[model samples]
Each structure stands twice: as structure tokens, then as C-alpha cells.
Target: MKYSSILFAAALVFLAAGAAAAKVPAGLDRIEHIVVIYLENRSFDNLYALFPGADGPSARTRWAPQQDRTGKVYDLLPPVPDQRFPAALINAPFLIDQYVPQDAKTPDLVHRFYQNQLQINGGRNDRFAAWSDAGGLVMGFYDGRTTKLWAYAKKYTLADHFFQGAFGGSFLNHFWLVCACTPKYDDAPEAIRAKLDDQGQLISDGAITPDGFAVNTIQSRFQPHAASVTDEARLLPPVDLPTIGDSLSDKGISWAWYSGGWDDALAGKPAPSFQFHHQPFAYFSRYGDGSDERRLHLKDEAELYAAIAANRLPAVSFYKPLGIENQHPGYANITNGDNRAADLIDKIMQSRSWKSTLVIVTYDENGGFWDHVPPPKGDRWGPGTRVPALFISPFARKGYVDHTPYDTTSILKLIELRFKLKPLGSRDARAKAPLGALMLESK
Candidate 1:
């Protein structure tokens, strides 16, 4: 059965019409394909406050709601307690050791790992530089459904509201986006030391065990990418549950991943490429076919830019840049990496395949940025974090801003519904379908 499935998929690719990639097929469940464009940091108030244009469902682009119905802006009482404004708290398991604000660079896990810790070297840490004064580190970012890349809001849709699922660092947020699940949200240490890929190689077994791989079964596959690089790995759940790639295969849909560098395929946690889900680690192991047929691993990040114009795009696509450009703490420039990422999405939008697809733009987490709305922890889909989310489609409502609460899981839920595939598990089956607001009635 699996062999026939493979043959069926190959047949579809051979016969897929080039020009047909631009239109959403009739009776296609919901969105036929989705592209998740997750960014680094920043929130809704910071980006949209100065953005002079059409916004929100109400068609107003005014600053935050710290105002009265009578045009009076009021300061929040008991004011939002955010560390990014005045000072951040140094929690335990942070900064290794703390030195009272010295002019020397030492190992500080709190400053590097904690999102709320805004200890910049050689300088002043302005709230505007880290986040906006309107809302503290928790303020979710709102995106212009239009003009993400010089495009018009009337032409696309903006999330206007989104938040991360966790309170710590980048690794956990990135993990959630991929798996729709994770066991350790912020349980791992800041300065993680691993027997696997942290500085070595990962060990794996077929079971979905938490520590990534069973220590006993971790034999050297000898292939450079064979094992993981982190021993501090957390187990991701619902293993048998279908991933997005699994659904694409069931529908005979094709997909591709163009990653940044050596660890571009999301390996090396406790290290740089910490964001990806755990499954990819086992997907193309040298223990299998030993052929790099499934994904495109690039040492050069620029190589992916050209695929934006390719006509035979897989039904689903995910791209993550490499190194300092991806906004790692070691080389962060605080320029709002999303601005550059937004530019990339803009480039992809002008392609020949814009009309038939949906692109979800959001952040993995706040990167210690702020949003006033505390993350909602409903019995199911979330307690989701708040970050700005953007939904872009040709059929998307112009100047629309959905007030509905959404998070990373909403994206997966939308895809599962639209594709008519089985949900990933309990999390997706019952999670709210926020994407329903983005689709046109005719669609």
C-alpha cells in the first residue's frame, strides 16, 4: 500500500499543471496549502503604532486601548509589571552567576536565556529599543494583513493579535510551532550540556521517548547528521499523530524544506538550530536510505531565494535562514528580524503562485518582548502566547483584523480541517479553528 502511495504521489507531480498553482481548487477542504512564516521578536503595539494605514476589523489604526470611549487615553493602573521597561528579574537557573552590573562580559544565562532579562552590554536598554512603552514584554504584535512587504492591507489580511505559548526562550516556542506539541516548555536549563548534539551527536530509538533518544540505543551512525547534538532534549508528544508532511503524503501532495546552514534542518538543540521538532531528526537518518531525497539542505541561505520564483513549488513549503541572520542571541542586532523576514514573505507573495495559498506569519515566541494580554490557557488548544499573526491570501478580506484569539496550534488546526485529514491528536481535534475567519465565504 505504501509503495502504491509513493507511485501515486510521483504521478501527481509529473502531471501537475504549472499555471494551475495559482488557483484554489473547488471543494478543496479549506486552504489547499499553507506556508508558516514565523519571525524572531517584537509585538503588535511596537510595529503597528507608527504604521499609518488601514487596520483592525474596525478600520482604525490608533495606538493601544489604554483609552476611554470618549477619546481619552489612560495609563493602566497597577501598570503592567514588565521587566523590559525598568529592570528585569534575574531568576534562578539564570546567568550561571550574577555580578552586580559590571562592565565585563561573562557567562550570564539569565541575560542570554530569559526572555524578560534585558541586560544589554555597554549601554542603555530603552523600552523602545527592546519593546514599546505602551505594553510591557507581553504585548502581542499585530501585523498589517497588507503592506507586509510594500503590499497594501486592502490586498491581504493581518492577524492583529498573537502570542507565544511559553515564557522563557526561543527554543521552546520554535518546537511548538513544528510539533503542535512539546513536553518540556521551559524545563531545560539555559546552559545545556548534552551527550548527543549539544556538542556531540544524538542517539535515537523508534520510541517517542522524551530524552530524544534512549541512551542505551544511541550508537554512532557515523553519518554527520545521523544523531542529534543535544542531551538536554525534551520529548515532543503525539508521535503517531500525523504531521503536516504526513497529510500532504496522504493527499499525494508534495512538499519541500529549504533550510539555512549545516543545522538548517532544525537539529543541534542546546545550540543554534534549536527550533525544529524532534521528528526531523529521525526522518532522513543515514540508517535509512542514505540518500538526501526528501529535503534540500543548503549551506548557503541565499540559494532558497531563487525558489520563490520556481513554478513547481511543493504544495507546502517552510524556509528558515541560518546563523546570526536568524537572530540568535550571540549575534542579535535588535533590528527586529521580522522586518527582514517580512521582506522575504513579500518576495514570495509576488510570485506566480500567490492566489491559491495561505501564508501564516507569526513569531515562535516574544523573545522576551512584551504583550499586555496574558496568554490564555483554555483547557485545550492553549494557554497560547500572544504574538502578531498574519493571514495572507488573494481571497483574504481587505483591511481585516480578526479579534479572535489564536496561537501556533490554530495554524495546524486550520490545515487539518481544510485538508480533510485526521487531526494530529486531541490537541488539534478540539482546538479552536481561528483560520475560519480568514477564508472567503465563496472559498
Candidate 2:
């Protein structure tokens, strides 16, 4: 071979060696089961604000003062509508437990896509209190160290810099959790399309964007949704994107989405808090109502327990708790939800799969709550505010605090890495898997 040809071959060898050296963290292949325990609506600051050795807030933390819609800075926070807070309060993050006990519920905040973007305020993260319908409550957080899950976190790995995938509420974030991409509503009616002000902030929240993206909550086209059968226009059109479930099934890997209240929802007697929009797979055409895949993969929360007890858990499982135990504000209290999550973890620890399983506990979104750290910019969709994400496994680094920048799709990336599956989109394609939190070469 010529000198140039030899040099080309040498360079190719060098590149290939580098790629091989960057393999998935050691011992990852041993994780046969990954359970993603997806809870609802809480920011990192809202839940883990007082966690030791984590990037939590303190009394001396500087806060960005909130500005009203007209760009006027607030001298005092607007009074909370519930009259639970003191009449006058400074414009900064406060301990919610000081007013409402950790066991109590608070009013829901506005967590729409456009509003979330506006609240982020170009990453300043100062508009939450201003844009929130619950007013000053947006800046409130609990002393999370008192929660039952805190003990689990102390025993495992806590990811302080993790973010939710999408820039909105549970609906879009749920879709991102499965697909790492936004759902489309290409021919949505104008009435439901969001109306934005000149500054690109939402004048009124809508289910679809002006450009035909479903960034907000909309009833699924499938059965068990709130929309009437005749109200086709009101329902979100069936999405065509491939989800993590699809990818796993294509590879003959077992997986299931076990949701609380799913069976009841199908029986047309859904709990009052059974949010139809939270079911991401129900909107996909492949999982259409009565589809065999739907029957096989979409299961009830009780099935998760049975599977755990029987050691019959799938390779990958996504578990969504019922609203009452999901830690969502407005209906769910933090204490009950935290206790439920701890109990679930306890049950899983006692299961046969415990030795080989990886359990990821995280929230769906910030739920319109405020956080100190701004999300790293990604695409037009999100990586919204910071949400609590933790790693629990025998292989997980004991009592470690992982500051690696990760989003909700990082969980999907972890699964993809373990299963050797291709990423569904650019978002998860670039997401850093959470393998760094695990012990390498344990075998």
C-alpha cells in the first residue's frame, strides 16, 4: 500500500479504538430489569431542596425577583388566593411547609408549554411566581429531608441536575419520556391553538400550538379518554411516532407500562383524579384501543406488584402511580405520595428481581414550580425545570450525589444502552445515560 493509504488506515484504527474505549459503563449489561417509577408534578426545589450534598437551596441563596406581565418587578409577592400565606411576603422562594404542612395539598399552578417557556424567561427562571395562577405559591418548596423517600435517596444515588424532558405539564413530558419527541397535531382547529402575545408568551393556554404541535394536555383518541366519540376535533389525533415500547418490542425485549387506575379507566369508571392525558401510549396509533399490543403491554399498577412478587417483571417497566399517590399538587399531598413511593421501593427490594434491577424514581415535570438552576438549552421542545431523579440499585453508588446533567430521556438512554437499541430521536441520542452512578465491573 502507498504511504497515504497506510496513514488513512492508521487514522481509521485510531478512531475505532476511541469508540470502543467509550463503551457503556461496566456491569450495565447485568441490569436485566429497569423500573422507571414516574411520579407527578414536583420540581427538585419543591421536593429535594434540603437534601444534603445535593444542589439544594439555602437561606442565603440569591433569587431573581419576579416581574409581572407588563415587566414591572414585584416589591411584594401577590397574595396567595387560598389565604394560607401571610398577606405580605418577599418575592423569593419560601418554605411551603412553613405555611401548609407537608402532608397538605396546595392549589395547582399553570404548567402549560408556552407559560413554562415564559416562566423560564430565557433561562432567567424568574417568572414562575409572576406567571403562575397560584401566584406566590409557585416559589414555595418543602423541606424535603423529612420525606420517607429521602432515606432511600440517602442510601442510593441522587441526581441533582436532572431535568424533565418537555417544557410543560405531565402530558407532554409523558410523551417525551417514551419518545423523546413532541406529539404532532398537524390539522388542529384554530380555536384550540395557543394564542401568543408579541413577546411569544401565551395569551391563553391551548391544547395545540399555532404551528400544529400538541404541547399541552389533550384527550387521547383512544377509549377511556374524556372526549366523546363524536368529538373528533376535540381529541388529539393519533400520533405516528415510535415509542420506547415499540423499540423494545421490535427487539423482542419484554416491557410494559403499568399505570394506576388504568383498568378502572378502561371500565369507564376512572377515578376522579385519573388523568387521561397522562397516558402517552394511548395516543399512539400502534397502541390503539383493542390492539393486541395494548392488551399485552398496557397494564394496571397491581400487575406490577404481582410481577415483582413472581419475579416475572419485564426487561423494562414504566410505572405511573395514581394521582392520589403521585405527589401532584392540588389533589395529592407530598407526605402520602412520598410514603407510597418508599413503600413501593421496599416491596421491590424484597422481590427476586432486586439483585439485578435498576429502579429510576423521577417526577414527570416541575408542575409550574420554581427552581434555582436553569435547564440546559436543547431543542424547541424542552428539558424544562429541574425535577428530582435518583438511581436505586444494588450496583448504584452508595449515598452518591450525581451532578451529571441529565433529562428525562436519560432514563430512555439508559434503557437503550442496556438493550443495545437505537435512539428514537436526537434528544435521547445525545442524552447521557446514568451509568456513571453504578458500580463498574462488579461481575
Candidate 3:
């Protein structure tokens, strides 16, 4: 009895010590600005497969053979429908630049909610080519070392294990970035709900689920948006849920969602390349047109640069480039977007706030690309396919590749921890913060 009592006390002491050691590192508090550059779809493997020191594919690695819907493994991958790629490619990851150079645009792959789940194939990650609209193009990747972003990665910290917070595409993942929860369309029409087979495989694609979750790309009902009043039945209603923007506002901290071509979109003269669904917060009631939140928080990309130049950037900033410069497949080529990103980083570095600022560059989702690393098992929404993320700050470890597993919600976690704000939802509350990259040393 005496020995047992002593052992219990020692265990308690050990746990207490661990708790103390887990406290937020002091250096994180020094960051005055948190800038999130949310780029368009590109998976870790899509852009960073050849990156040194990353868990990237190598010549010796064996890729999982793709299986068709009936479960037959393909000996040769299906031909890329547009004939942009070779017709007789084998069933494995290939260096895309060898055939279709990075400067040329490629056909966009199917990246909808149901299709993504189907392609993941219960985490085997072997059905991407079978389910992809772009066929074997899904298995293609670039030699990232040749890209401009790779140069910045070599000088900063690259997070090799980070994933998108949600499955599917930009619209849903953008919401996850702010709220860490799926948006709801509670009274959605039956016609819009996804039709699933008995095996839970998608028979037809949909913007909303049977139970009312908005999983696929859907237009917002607000003005300056793509949807009109006549399209109300299909559009997403004003979301009433709290977002990271709301939390920041409550504390009187400055923040903004800066998107390219915002001013033109509002004037009904939007650029041909402007995307409506990319503006996630515009769907919220608090940020309706003419509302103070809308006027003050939603601005043009030019404003972001002006703020940076003037050294009065907001405490939190989200910059979404125009579709033409966003690096999305089909619409934009990789080289143009790569140059734009490098330019943004150079401008940010010129700011006086650069010393105390942390810039996180990440993609919305994998864009239906094939990645060898299976995402960690998460909830129905996700911590989806691995996406390349980087930390560019003076405090970031120079030339380091951080392998800590994180998702889109990790951005929220970092914001909440630095400002002592409450988490917007369960996902962010439980998410592991990106302190491994932000902190000065191992915690």
C-alpha cells in the first residue's frame, strides 16, 4: 500500500511537468501580423514532390496501382482525354513537365466532395486516375525544385505534413479555414442533394448533402456575387455561424479579406477571370453588402499592397489572388502564378512589419491530384490530401522542413493562441497549432 501511494504521487508529478512544458512558447507572442496567402489548388506532390528533405516521391518509391470503379487495377493509365499527355503511360506518378511543360495550362480534374471521397478509396489513395475527369493527368506532378516558390522554400521553413482542413475544393476549404466547420443549407431542395449508392459511393454530384451540409462549390446569395435573386433556390443562404473574422472583430483587432478584382466585382464589371465562390466570407450575414463589416473587412488586393507599403497592415490578413494568377489548373498555368507569389513575398519582405510578421502560404485543396501519403484519419469533412505549406518569417527556421502534421485549422489555432481568442469551432479547438514552424526552438 505504501509503495503504490508513492508511485501514484510520482506519476502525478510527471504529468504536471509535461503540462508545464507544453505551454505556448514565448517567442510566438512577438508576432504582430499574421498573413495567410490562400492560393488555388495544388497538392504537396503536385508542386513539391522533388523538394529536398520532404517526404516526397523518389525514383525508388513504388506507387499504388490505380483501380477502376469495379476494382480492377489498371496496367496502363487511361489516356488524358485532351491528348495533351502521352497515350501509353504506365500506372504510376510521372514527371509532368517532361510532356506538358509547367508554362502550359492543363485540363482541370474533378475535385468535388463525393468524387474526392471516392478517389481516396478509404485512404489507399489508388483511385485518383479512375475517378478523375482529367484521367491519368491526376497522377502527374512537377519537378518542384525548378519552380520559383522552391527558391523561397529553400530559404524558409516548409511544412511537408500539412493537409487542407476539408475535402473537396476551394469553396468548402475556404470556409474551413475560417470556421473549421462545414456550412449548412438546411432546407436545400431534394434535386440539389447528392445521390449516393448503397455503398455510399456518389451516383450524382451535388453542392449540398442529403443532410444539408454544403460540401461542393455553391454560389453565395449576396450582391457582388455570381448568383442572382432568380437563382436563390440553389444559392447558399447567409451563413449565421461565427467565423475567425467575427472573433477578431469582437476583440477590436484589425483584419481583412483581400481578394483581387473585388472593386470590379462590386461594380458588375468583374474580370473574366474573377471567381465568385472564392470569396467565402461574403456569404455571411454580418458581411452583407453595405454592412460595416463588408465595407471595412472585404477589400481589393491593391489595398493589401498599400497596407504593406505603408507599414500599417492589419493584424490578420488573407490575400486571395485573381483566378488568372491563382495557379488553378485549366484556367491558369503554373509559371504565371509562381511568379506572382514570389512577387507578393518580395513586397511583404520590404515592409517594416516583416521582422515581426509571419506569412503562411498554402493551397485550398489538393485539386484532385494524386499524393502518396494518406491523410491522417479525420472527420467526415477532413484533413484532406497533403498540401504544401510554408512559413516565411524572420523567426522561421532557416532551410528547415517541418514534418509536423497540421491542417487548415492549424492557421486558426495559431491565431487563437497568439491573441488568446476562443476557437471558432471544435476542429480549431482541437487542432495542433503550427508552433513547430513558428516557434524559435523545439518545445
lDDT of 3 at 184: 79
Better of 1 and 2 by TM-score: 2
> In what order do the candidates fall by lDDT, top score first?
3, 2, 1
lDDT of 1 by residue, 255-302 (tens): 555555534332433235433332232322321224453333322235
In candidate 2, position 242 carries an lDDT of 75
What tens digits encode model 3's per-residue C-alpha lDDT throughout 306-393? 9999998999999999998999998988998888888888998988999889999999999989988888887778888889999999
Q: Ten consecutive residues with minimal summed lDDT in candidate 1?
A: 91-100
- Residue by residue across 1-443, what tens digits does model 2's lDDT show? 00113322443354344322124556788888999999999999888888888887676776577878777889988878787888887888788888999888899888988788879887888888778898888888888777778888899999999999989888899999998767778788888888776666557668987667788888887877973446688898888877899989998999999989999999988998888887899999999999998999999999998998898989999988888989898999998888878888888899889998888999999999989888998767778999999899998999999999999999988888888877776677778998778885764
- Which residue pairs collide in model 3, if any? none
Cα lDDT, model 3, residue 305? 93
After superposition, the stretches of candidate 2 with alpha carbons farther than 4 Å from their true spots are: 1-23, 197-201, 227-230
Candidate 1 Cα lDDT to native:
0.42
114 in model 2: Cα distance from truth in Å?
A: 0.6
TM-score of candidate 3 on Cα atoms, chains taken together? 0.93
